[model samples]
Target: MATIFTIPGSLRSGSSNHNILKFLGTLVPDGINYTIYDSLATIPPFDPGLDNDTTPQPVAELHRLITNADAIIICTPEYAFGVPGQLKNALDWLVSSGTLVDKPVALITASSSGEYAHPSLLRTLGALSANVIEEACLLVPFIRARIQDGVLDDELKEQLESAFESLLKAL
Candidate 1:
């Protein structure tokens, strides 16, 4: 089975980005395994000095998850017109590890106006040598309006399924 690691780049409990990721998890096709890495909040701030064989527990765990996954999907919200600090910090920890090198990645920027973080996230993932599938990457603007009562609308669901299909094909 193909294993997909999902990262929701928001710490807020009720974030629309997080909700969308949750929705995507439920739509995984047969023969595919989907897991959401829900430990971003527990990860310590990135520090080059600490990026070594003796990495912190949380960082090591994150590394392990990424290393074992067949593909990755990241759904994030733009913060202050840029990538969120927490998500950026998590990516920073992977820079030297090579865990993401050539890994197939799907990026979804979900927010009111996600243009800024969408490109910024792509640049960062590219720098890490990840093979980001362009067709799978999406900028979902006004995301809050698309979700109601914890469920994504049919149209958004179809978009997510298309992105997920593209990601699987790239894998």
Candidate 2:
């Protein structure tokens, strides 16, 4: 069975970014398993002192989750026109652990205006050597307004489902 690990880049409780993840869970059709990593809050800051030694338990667990997954879906929310520090920290941890290297990844962001962070994040992911599936990316502006009650608008639901299905095919 193919498995996909989805990371919601926003730490906001009940954030639309996370709501999209929940929607994705329901959309995971037969023949594919989608797992949501809901422990982002437990991951500690990246510290070199913990690098090779027994790292923070949560960090190790997160690494294992990504390392075992067939692909990754990252949904971020831009903060100050750039990536959130928490998400960047998580990626930094993955970089040192080599968990994301060569993994097929889809980078997405929820925005109120435009894809302000996508370009920077795309470049950063490229530098990390992740096999990012650019075609699978999406920049959803005014996501909260566009998605109603945890469901995407009629027009966007099909698009999101198709994007996910495409990522599944790649996996």
Candidate 3:
């Protein structure tokens, strides 16, 4: 069974990004072991000072989690018209560790139509040496309206299912 590492870019508990991740969790089919990084809020701001041998335990755990995962799925919401600070901070921690190098990753965005923020994320992920599967980018427009209680609307659900399949194949 493949291990799926889910990263919700939002730190807010009820954020749309988190909700999207929950929706994807339900889409994980049989034989797939999955886990979501629920400690984004606990991650401190990335700093060279703290990147040494004795960093906080939570930061070390986060690095270990990403390094051990088979594949990564990121569900993010745009903040200030760009990637959220928490998500960027998480990636910053990985920049010096090479944890995501050559890793198969899928970036999903939950935003209104015509409001996607993936190109920037894609560029950043590529710069970090991630093998981002282009076909696995899932954009759920009007996400709040389309997915309720972690259940996607019929059309979005189908798209998410297909995206999940594509991600698994990318691995």
Candidate 4:
């Protein structure tokens, strides 16, 4: 079975990013193990000193999940015109571990104006040497308008479906 892991950049309970991940889960085919990681808030701040084998349990678990997954989907909302703090911290933990290196990853930046954070995250992922699927990368501005009552608009849904299909094909 193909293992697919998803990460939501926001810690907010009703986050659009989390909702997007949930929607993505439904697009997975049978026999694929899909998981939406909900522990971004639990991961402590990045410390180069603690990046060894004895890392924190949450960070270690995240590393293991990414290392084992066939592909990863990250849906995030920009904060303060930049990547969310918690999400960036989580990526920081993965840098030394090299867990994302060569991993098939799809990035979705959904926010009021995801312009800044979308490309910012792309650069960060590039630094990690992640094999990001260009066709799977999406930037959805005014995201709140694209989703209503947890339902994505037709255009957004179609775009997400196409991006997800691209990621699945890369696996």
Pairs with backbone N, CA or C atoms under 3 Å apart (clashes), candidate 1: none
RMSD of each: 1.0, 1.5, 1.8, 0.7
lDDT, candidate 4, 96-145, per-residue tens: 88999999999999999999999999999999999999999999999989
Q: Report every candidate's CA lDDT.
A: 0.92, 0.83, 0.82, 0.94
Worst 10 residues of 1 by lDDT: 21-30
Best by lDDT: 4
Q: How big is the positional error of residue 121 in model 2, measured in Å on the Cα after superposition?
A: 1.6
RMSD of 3: 1.8
Give the TM-scores of the predictions, in the order they appear.
0.96, 0.92, 0.91, 0.98
Q: Model 2, 1-171: lDDT tens per residue? A: 778999988888778888888877888878878887888878889888887767889888988998889999998889898888888888877777788889999887886754768888888888778999877788888877887766678766776787787787788
Question: Backbone clashes per model, in order?
Answer: 0, 0, 0, 0
Runs of candidate 1 exceeding 4 Å displacement: none
What is residue 129's positional error in candidate 2, in angstroms? 1.2
- Candidate number achieving the greatest TM-score relative to the actual structure: 4
Error of 3 at 74 (Å): 0.4
C-alpha displacement of 23 in model 1, angstroms? Answer: 1.6
What count of clashes does model 1 give? 0
